[model samples]
Target: MSVRCLLPLVIVAIVAVSGANFKRREFKIKIDGEVSFKATPPLSSGKTITWKFKDLQGGVIRVMDFDYDESATPQNPLFKNCASADKKTGELTLHNLTENHSGLYFFELNGKEQMEKFPLKVMRVVQKPEITNEKTTSNPDVVYLKCKYDKVVDKDAKISWSCSNDTTEELAYTKTGKTDLCCACTLKNDVSQETSDQICESDLFHEGSNIALTVVLILLFILLFVVIVLVLMYRFNNKFHDYVFKKYEKTTCLGGMLKNLDQCRSGKKTGVKQTDVTTVYTEVNKIEENNKEDDPLTDPQHDYEEPQSGDKQTDVENGTPLKKEDNTPTEHSDDL
Candidate 1:
């Protein structure tokens, strides 16, 4: 055992030797609880009883005093509101205890201190422990469990598991059976103990169902990844298509411009030749004379209509010559 485990015994032995008639008791109480200590050989009508506290640092402070026929007077300001004494029963009750109130307590009869002493220890209640299922065996028939309390408040606390097999270990394994198995975790200390909620062993160790769920999750994740990849590829393909189209349009425009520039350069190198307008007019006049030779009016079987009076008058006013087969050609004027 550690020194801390043996310290109480050492203190008890020392006190035994110092006070042969001393009666000592160790007490454990939760925070905000109450404790009552009675004086041996209860107080008489005229007797006086006093309570005193000795702190962990060996400093003593008077707590309360009671005189059966006189009055009850409290001394320590720290315990003024929390301490009370029974004048008839010679009992001192301390309420609202805290860790700071943990220490030795002494009682006095009349003017002399009593041999009985009380050692008080104040502590908080233990919290519930958690149990988890662990996979420790390759066999599907076996189930492994681990019980733990991470936020342990007491140093002397113990962790244990209560199962159908009655296990005391923090880590325990058991075989699965036809019937349901239940388990719980417990944490215990010198002051208090707490037991966790029961868990169903078979439900917790559903290996086959767990495997199926894991597979489904993995397949879903793969499908999601494939979908994301496809979406990215589609967006990239559209951008690539747009880029190629724009590049082709630009190339086509550049080629047309270059072709036009080459044509201009060729024209500059080989000078332009102009056609004569008089040759074009003479060809037109020859075509007109050939058409007149094939005219229906010159044929002997053809009948021609005479010009109207309005048409003759308009032609004469405009100084236009009237057509006749026997008429001679007119000379040109200087203005023409």
Candidate 2:
């Protein structure tokens, strides 16, 4: 053969040997001391191998079979030919092994046995340091931060808090327990008007952990304002009532004074010359006369009157007789 043709053959032979060596590599495994099982040797293509377990007394107790790869392993194959006790280990070899082959293998010796559970799990790497902020008041002086997590685990967890604008070193925290965790940080001294972008954060090992809180202070302020207004209104109403009563009393007093003045004016306008007044005066005079008549000693000549004489006397009284006619007075007395 020519040199070029011979070189190609040599390269192909080397590649075939390398592939076989890769397929025959032994699988790494760690077993629990309570369980004993035979480690089966790697098999070639289209071949099967059996894994058997023995008790402490060296008696065969259990057996399991596995088949090698019939086709080339795909890059993302769902199943692989490897068995381990921990989930972090690789996939279990199950070429011919169906659903029935999946279970714990146990061996009994002298009524005592060891059990080996197979097909470890493969956990996905999750994002860490799940951070969130609680709802807080805009008054930076009265606010605080609270951090929490959804679940607890054995791994070492860390928490970090920092102001958004300031690049200072962050505050760190650590905790380990079976219950949920929380922490409070006061921002009274640390916060200012310029620190409006303040924030709080947490670091956890698992995903979906979160924190939340709320502040409601405006309602209290509104309640206080309402109380003050009510108090002021009550005081104003009381003062107004007192003023109204005073005005009403003054009006009543003025009305009484006007009534008295009207009575005095009416008396002056009507003089005492009417018939009723005359009759009253006559009755008063009659009463006085009756009282005088009842007293005899008060009037001595009540019925006395003057006598007249005619001209028929003798010669001695001739002068008197002759003047008899003239003796009778012509005017009568005012008493009659």
List per-prediction Cα lDDT, in the order shown. 0.72, 0.37
In order of listing, the candidates' clash counts read: 0, 4
Q: What TM-score would each prediction reach against the true structure?
A: 0.51, 0.19
Off by over 4 Å in 2: 1-46, 51-63, 66-153, 156-170, 173-239, 242-336
Q: What overall lDDT, based on C-alpha atoms, would model 2 receive against the true structure?
A: 0.37
**Which model scores highest in lDDT?**
1
Poorest 10 consecutive residues by lDDT, candidate 2? 186-195
| Model 1: residues with Cα > 4 Å off, grouped in runs | 1-24, 137-144, 150-152, 164-169, 207-336
Score residue 110 of candidate 1 by CA lDDT: 86
